[model samples]
Target: MSGAMRMLAGLYRPVESQTPYGGRSVTFEAMGSAWLACGARRRSERGEGDEHHAVETMSAETRDDPRLETGRVLRFGGADWGIVTVRPLRPGRVGLELERRR
Candidate 1:
């Protein structure tokens, strides 16, 4: 199970989170990354969310990592996004629910 995940590790984007070091200072730390499978969760029988877009699309599958915690800001590609859920899938893997910070 875990071996399957390891096979795809190279596909994941590296994400980082900053840790405060002192006054007005911080240090960047690696929070790892996951292969994101992006998609829009449909609101109804149609296909995608047409009206209520604020309700996040729910079907983003990601490579499971333990560090993917809710409320943590992960920096990806020079942008930061907040984690909404870190769901455990099979052993050694987790699904990450993320939302862009405003």
Candidate 2:
């Protein structure tokens, strides 16, 4: 697989959300990182379809030593979104939050 794909896939973590039935619910995974912008293409179009510029940087390391990055996307989700912080929780776990634009 491509380097970026491998990186993205490696970020997947098993997720088990709370259920009202007091039983295990859907078995899925959560993305270790959001605001992904490594592969975004730049454009000069001024219309609504024009792409915005993005910037990112290495954030922290997982318990398994896998590196993570904070991606920043300008003008996304109807606002400027950025991975502002990353905190290591434990081996193979991390907490990430977005930095609100002012």
Candidate 3:
């Protein structure tokens, strides 16, 4: 909530509904936007036999919002980031661990 906030990330909530065929469907509904101070990008690599997997993650700080929860979708920088974890940072701020979605 200060000048250090550089990114305006849009938050989305998952909405689940029951289908007529007794199936379930999930969709994202736009919650709102929040200013976040994104930290440095981190990358990790994993290998499983002959397969290799790369994951990109980053930390960000933003004002505490009740709708901001894990499994939510965040859209910014022309990409979608999945909320991996959320923790309270201070009285009104929360720390977020985001993973870049493929």
Q: Sort by lDDT, best first.
A: 3, 1, 2
Model 2: per-residue Cα lDDT over 10-102, one tens digit each: 243334677987877644343444333233222232324565444332332223333344553223334433455666766666644444323
lDDT of 2 at 66: 39
C-alpha lDDT (0 to 100) for residue 14 of candidate 3: 84
Query: Candidate 1's residue-wise lDDT over 1-102, tens digit each?
Result: 232222122222334455475334334455555665544433333235574333332434565665566766555444455667778776765676656522
Candidate 3, superposed: residue stretches over 4 Å from native = 1-5, 15-26
The lDDT of each candidate is: 0.50, 0.40, 0.87
Q: How many clashes show up in model 3?
A: 0
Identify the superior model by TM-score, candidate 1 or candidate 2. 1
Over the full model, what C-alpha lDDT does candidate 3 score relative to the true structure? 0.87
Better of 1 and 3 by lDDT: 3
What tens-digit string does per-residue lDDT give for candidate 3 at 1-102? 344447999999888999999999999899999888988778887768998777789889988988888999899999888899999988999999999733
Pairs clashing within candidate 2: 63-91, 63-92
